[model samples]
Target: MLAAHFDAPGGPDNLYIKEVDRPVPKEGEVLVQVHASALNRADLLQTRGYYPPPPGASQIIGLEAAGKVVALGPGADGRWKIGDRVMALLTGGGNAQFVAVPATQLMPIPPGMTDTDAAAIPEVWLTSYQLLHFVGKVRKGETVLIHAGASGVGTAAIQLCRLAGVLPMVTAGSAEKLEFTKKLGAASGFNYKDEDFGTKCLEATKNVGADVILDCVGATHWQKNLQCLNTDGRWVVYGLMGSGEIHGDFLTLLLRKRGSLLASTLRSRSHEYKEELVKAFTEQVLPYFSPGGSIQLRPIVDSVFPFDQIADAHRRMEANKNMGKIVLQIPV
Candidate 1:
C-alpha cells in the first residue's frame, strides 16, 4: 500500500508517498478499502510535528475516511460484514488505500449517499456536533455564535444549530463565505476582518449576548468571547488559530460573571470517548442526513486533489483560502 509519509514535520512539502506494508485487522479492528479521505487542521498540525498519533494508531496522516469493509477481524461484530460501505472516524492513518478502523467506530453510509461525500461527513460534522450538543449544550431559541463559519466544522455547526431551533450567528473572512454560511442556515454572518464580532453579535441579539459560543479561534477572541457570552453562558474553545497567549485577568472575569470556561482538543480524547461520540452521532445525529433534517452535509468541496498532491492541499489549507472541505482521492 502507498501512504503519505513525512520524514520530518514542518510543511506540506514534507509529505511524501511511499509503499508501506498493508495492515491486517486485529481482533477488534476492521480493514477498510478507503475511497476518499478529508483534510482537517489536525492533519496540518500532525505534518508540522505539533501533534502525534495516539499509541497503537497509524502514524499516517488522516482522521476520517469513507470506504468499504474488505475484511472483518476475528472478534468483529455481525452488525458489520465484508463489503458493507461505511464511514469511520479515527485518530490517524486515513490517507492510504487501505486503513484499519475499530469496528465499533464504523457507521453505515446512508442509502443513496455517495462514498466520496460520505468521506467528508464524519470528522467535521461529528466534531461540530459534539461541540454544539455535548459541550455547548445549546438550547432551542438560544443564540449561538460560531467562528470560521465557512470551514467544514463551521458549516456543520450552522446546520446543526438550525435543526436544534437555535439561532446561529457566524463569523468568517469574506462576504462570499458569509453568503455560503447563510445558505447553510446561519441567521447572521459577520465578516470578522471588518467588524468586531462581539459587538455585531451583541447587536444581532439586541445586546442580550450569546447563550453559547463555539469558538475555534482562541486567544485572539478570548476576551471578546467572554464579553459576548450571556450570563452563565458557556464558552467552548476547540482551537487557537490566532495566538495562544493570555493577557487579561481571567480569575476576576470568572468570579465576576460566574461563567463557565471549557476547552478540549478532539484528538487527545480517549478511544472510549471517541467511540461514544461516534455512537451518539450515529443515533441522535446521523438521521439528519436522511432527508428532512436541515442538518444535511453539503460537503462543500473546494477541490479534489490527487493523492500525490497532498502538499498542494496543505498549502491551500495553510493559505486559509478554501471555502469548504478539501478531499484527497486515493488512486484505485
Candidate 2:
C-alpha cells in the first residue's frame, strides 16, 4: 500500500509517498479500501511537527476518508460486510490506499452520495455538529457567529445551523467565500479582512448579539468575540489559527458579560466520548443530510492532487488559498 509518510515533520516538503505494508483489522476494527481522503488544517500541523498522532494511533497523515469495507475483525457485525461503502473520521492514516478503522467510527455512505463528496463530510460535519449542539448549545431562533465560514467546517456549520433553524452570522476573508457561505444557508456573512466581524454580527442580529460564537481564529478575535456574545452566551473556541497564545483580561470580561468560554479539541477525546459524539451525530445530524433533508455535503474541492503531491496540497492550505478541502486521490 502506498501511504503519505513524514518521519520527521518540518514542512510539506518532508512528506513523501512510501510503499508500506497494508494493515490488517484488529479486534473491533474494519479494513477499509480507501477511495478518497480530505485534508484538514491538522494535516498541515502534523506535517510541520506541531501535531502528532495520539498514543496508539497510526503515524500516517489524514483524519477523514471515504472507502469500502474489505475486511472486518472477528467482533465486527455483518452490518458492514465486504464492499460496503462508508465514510469515517479516523484519528490518522487516511492518506493511504487502505486503513484499519474502529468499526464504531464508520458510517454507511448514504444511498446516492459519491465517495469523494462523502470523504469531505465526516470530520468537518462532526466537528461543527459537536461544537454547535454540544458545546454551544445552539437552539432554534438563536444567532451564532462562525469564523472561517468558507472553510470545510464553516460550510458544514452553516448548513447545520440552517437545519436547526438557527441564524448563522459568518465571517470569511473573501467576498466570494462569503457568497459561498450564503448559499449554504448563512443568514449573514462578513469579510473579516474589511469589517469588524463582531460589530457586523451584532448589527445582523439587531444588536441582540450572537448567542454563540464558534471561533477558530483565536487571540486576535478573542476580545471581539467576547464583546459580541449575548449575556450568558457560550463562546466555543475550537482552534487558534491567528495566535495560539492569548493575553486578555479574561476574568474581567467574563465577570462583566457573565458568559462562558469553552475550548474544545475533538482529536484528544476519550474513546467513549468520541463514540458518544459519533452516535449523536449519526442520530441527530446525519439525518439532516439524508435524502430530502435541508443539509447535505456541498464540498468545495479546491483541487485534487496525486499522492506524491501531498506537499503541494499542504502548501495551498497554508497559504489560505483553498475555499474548501484539498483532497489527495489514492490511485487504484
Candidate 3:
C-alpha cells in the first residue's frame, strides 16, 4: 500500500507518497481500502512538527476517509461485513490506499452520496456536531457565534445550528465568504478584518449577546468572546488558530458572565467516546445527508486533488483558500 509520508518535520514540500506495508486489522478494528480522504488543520500541524499522533495511532496525517471495508478484525464482524461502503472517523493513517480503523467508528455511506462527498463528512461534520451538542449542550432558539464560518467545520456548524433551530452567526475574512455563509444559514456574518465582531454580533442580537460561542481562533478572539457572551453562556474553544495567549483578567470576565469554559479535540478522544459520538451522529445526522431525507444536508467539497498533489492540497488549505473541505483522491 502507498501512503503519504514525510521524512522530517517541515512544510508541504516535504510530503511524498511511499510504499508501506499494509496494516493488519487489530482487535475490534477493520481494514479499509480507502478511496478518498480530506485535509484538516491537524495534518498541517503534524507535518510542521507541532502535533504528534496520539499513543498507538497511525503516524499518517489524515483524520478522515471514506472507503470500502476489505476485512474485519477479531470481534469486529457482527456490525460490518466485507465490501461494505463506509466513511470512517480516524485518528490517523487516512492518507493512504489502505488504513485500519475501528469498526464501530465506521458509518455506512448514505444512498446516492459519492465517495468524494463522504470523505468530507467525518472530521468536520462530526467535530461540529460534538462541539455544538456534546460539549456546548446548545438548545433550540439560542444564538451561537461561530468564528471561521467559511471553513469546513464552520459550514457544517452553520447548517447543524439551523437544523437544531438555533440562530447562527459567523465571522469570516472576506465579504464573499460572509455572503456564502449567509446562504448556508448564518443569520449574520461579520467581516473580522473590518470590524469588531463582538460589537457587530451584539448589535445583531440587540445587545443580548450569544447563548453559546464556537470558537477556533483563540488568543485574538478572547476579549471579544467575553464581550458577546450571554449570562451562563457556554464558550467552547476547539482550536487556537490565532495562537493561545490570553491577556487581562480572563477569569474575571468569565466569572462575571458565569460562562462555562470548555475545550475539546475529537482526534485525541478515547475510542469509547468516539464510538458513542459516531453512533449518535449516525442516528441523528447521517440520514439527513441523503437526497430523499426530510431535511437535506450536504457535505461541502471545495476541491479535490490527486494523491500525488498532496502538497498542493496542503498549500490551498494553508492559504485559507478553501471554502470547505479539501479532498485527496487515493490512488487506485
What order do you get sorting by TM-score, best first? 3, 1, 2
Q: Per-residue error at 226 for model 1, in Å?
A: 1.5
Q: Could you say which candidate leads in TM-score?
A: 3
Tens-place lDDT per residue, model 2, 203-241, is 888777888899999888887887788988888999999
Q: Which candidate comes out best when scored by lDDT?
A: 3
Number of clashing pairs, model 3? 0
Q: Can you write out model 3's per-residue Cα lDDT over 1-332, one digit (the tens) per residue?
A: 99999999999999999999999999999999999999999999999999999999999889999999999999998999999999999999999999999998999999888899999999999999999999999999999999999999999999999889999999999998999999899999999889999999899999999999999999999999999999899999999999898889999999999999999999889999999999999999998887775677889999999999999999999999999899999977
- lDDT rank, highest first? 3, 1, 2
Error of 2 at 143 (Å): 0.6
Cα deviation at 284, candidate 2, in Å, is: 2.3
For model 3, what is the C-alpha lDDT against the true structure?
A: 0.95
Off by over 4 Å in 3: none
Model 3 weakest 10-residue run by lDDT: 288-297
Tell me the deviation in Å of residue 175 in model 2: 1.2
